[model samples]
Target: MSLLGATALVAVALDQWVKWLCTEHLTEGRPVKVLGGLIYLSLLRNSGAAFSFGSAHTWIFPVVTLIVIGWIAWMATRLRSIPWAVSLGLVLGGAFGNLGDRLFRSPGPFQGHVVDMISLFEPYGQHFAVFNIADSCLTVGVALAVLLELTGRQRDGSKAVKKAT
Candidate 1:
């Protein structure tokens, strides 16, 4: 539990710090190569769902983000016996990071765009939206969680735990 907690805290802090750097330094739509083009730092503010979808819907994005975060928090409390506590924790942390930005960063409550900096993909073509560390954690965490759920393996590689014990 401590390990998961510590990792979650680290993820949140790292995500926030990088986002701050992005907003402070990078220009919107400009890319700064980090590894000869394999990776770059590009500033982007996404007001919508992942990959910048539903951007025009405005009000809906924040509401859904809030709902998702709320559900994640509730699930966290009920997550005992699941072996993927750390992964779940990461997901929660990442969700909170982006949610925090949406709630308090520029623009307004539930209206602020998430600061994205880390960009990794091929150039000379359409690329994935620029995203931050928190996004990475959320992606990996969700993928892992879903995989576990589908395979019936918890974080410990055991079956879903029985909490009634």
Candidate 2:
């Protein structure tokens, strides 16, 4: 539980810190090269999911995020493996980070836009979706969770026994 809480807190702190930096220094719609064009910092405000899908139904995101947060909390109560704890922590932190934006950012509560700044390969997300640290955490956490499941690693720190076919 300690590991999970600490990881979540750290992820949220780092995510929010970077978002604050981006909001303070980056200009909207302008791309700043970060790694010789491999990556660029371009500010964008997205009210919907990846690629700005379902932007018209922005309220749904916060509701879904809250449910996810609750589910993660429930899972944490039974978590025993360090890897699972970290994975869930990252997911929870990412959800909370984005939820904060939805609840407190501009354009009113539950309709606020997420601040995205990182663009890959091309400017203004021509090559990829513009995302933030929270998105990165969510993606990595989900990937790790999938890998763990595929390997038969259980949340109780035990390996699943292969059954005879």
Candidate 3:
């Protein structure tokens, strides 16, 4: 199988497993300290997009996710190199993780929310928004894609320079 396909499967599995563990162990609004206030697992759910945006338009979120995943899947089949394949795989995995929740999670179908548990920062102030494994994978994948693009790693196919007569 392709690297992207394998990585995507792993990512989806890992994300789902971690989310399940967090939901089963942690209580909402309560922190399970894992480090010296630098990280913790806290169970929470978001009915909206990143950082809890669009909370009021819950239905719209899943629709958008589906569209994004469909586009990504289509793009994945066209990936021409390793970096892009890996990046797309990560995106696909993360997308599927959340998509699963939206499809079969508690509360209702197509209206289900994402479970977020990983957190970092002190409770007093400047804390990052709660996120899940899938979110992290997606963030890392996007960062990798950006780095590849910025460093010109995405253009490795052309012939080397040669002096003209």
Candidate 4:
């Protein structure tokens, strides 16, 4: 399998497993301190986008995720660089993880809630929104993609050279 495929599968598996563990061990809407209040594991069923944005419109995310997945699949056709593979894989897997919930989890088809459990800065009153493994993977992947772009790294193993003035 290609590196993207392999890494995507790995990310998907890990995301799902971590979500399962959170569902089993974490209490819904109740924070469990993991680092003396610095970090907490608290189950939150996000019905919409990140930070609970648009929670009233839970149906939109699945459609967006589908589009993203399709775009990634199309992009994979020309993937060559290791960085691109890794970034694409992370994106693909994270998308699938949330997509699976929207498809298979409760509340109805294409309107399911995403499982989030990790929180940072709670002790400082920041109460940062809780997130899940899939979110982290997606964030990392997107960050890497941005870094690659800024560094002129191309997806097909070619450098994006600057034009002469």
Candidate 5:
């Protein structure tokens, strides 16, 4: 539990710090190439989910994020594996990071836009969606969780016993 909490706090702090820096230094819609066009820092405000889907319904995101947070909290009670704890911690941190934006960022509560600044391959997200550290953490954590599950790893730090086919 200590490890999980620490990991979550660190992730949240790092995400927010990077976001603050980008918001303060980067201009919206202007790309600053950091890696010779492979990666660029381009600030954008997204009011929706991946690729700006369902942007017209900004209120739904906060509600969904709350549900996800609740679910993670419930799952925490069953966490015994260090790997699972770390993965879930990352997910929790990412969720909270984005949720903060949804609840507090500009436009209004529960209708605020999330600040995205990292662009890959091309500027202005021409190659992909502009994302943040929180998004990266969510993707990596979910992928790790999926990999663990597929390998029959249990949250209780035990290998699942397979029955004879």
Candidate 6:
């Protein structure tokens, strides 16, 4: 899982750097178009998961994030395939990206909010949920992992038995 470790570190660095830029340059709740009206950087402080779900349970996210981090670390020891490594790296990085906020950002530790700034879907009048690079990485990584699974590729570099048609 050396590849996974390296990829995860890189992902975390990139995610955190992007978030830092958003925190330093973008104003919260203020939308600034970057690539026309379709894409904008709209800063937000999320105390919950996607779409601001479970905002009331801010403390729980940090705990869950920690669990996820630990789980990824455990998985790293056995990771083999590139797809698996990349996928896990993205998940791990995204988890830590937000975890960093939960552990260090404003309000209080383990109750801090995630920093989101990227937004899309302006052609429809209403933008999609505010998100960040970490979220993007997580979505892509998960999709890739699912694709790998469906294609009979196992995380440990083995192929699954093909079922009779």
- lDDT per residue for candidate 3 within 111-139, as digits (tens), equals 78899887788542246778888888888
Winning candidate number (lDDT) = 2
Q: How many residue pairs clash in each candidate?
A: 3, 0, 0, 0, 0, 0
Candidate 6 TM-score versus the reference: 0.92
TM-score of candidate 5 versus the correct structure, residues matched by position: 0.97
Question: Which sections of candidate 5 miss by over 4 Å?
Answer: none
lDDT of 5 by residue, 30-130 (tens): 78998788999988999998789999999998999899989988888888999998998899899889999999999999999999989899877877898
- lDDT (Cα) of model 3: 0.77
Model 6: clashing residue pairs? none
TM-score of each: 0.80, 0.98, 0.86, 0.94, 0.97, 0.92
Where is model 4 more than 4 Å wrong at Cα? 123-126
- Report lDDT (Cα) of residue 90, candidate 6: 86
Question: Could you give candidate 4's per-residue lDDT for residues 37-117 as a string of tens digits?
Answer: 778777788897877899898888999999999999999997889999999899999999999988888898888989878
Task: For each candidate in turn, give its C-alpha RMSD to the true structure in angstroms.
Answer: 4.4, 0.7, 3.4, 1.8, 0.8, 2.0
- Which residues of candidate 3, in runs, are more than 4 Å off? 123-126, 155-165
lDDT of 4 at 103: 86
Residue-wise lDDT of candidate 2 within 11-98, one digit each (tens)? 8999999999999998987789977899999989999999999999999999999999999999999999999999999998899889
- List the candidate 2 regions with Cα displacement exceeding 4 Å: none
lDDT of 1 by residue, 1-165 (tens): 554566668889999988888788878767788778888777777887667887776567667666876776666555554447767777877877888888887788877788877767642114776678888888988897888787677544458555695
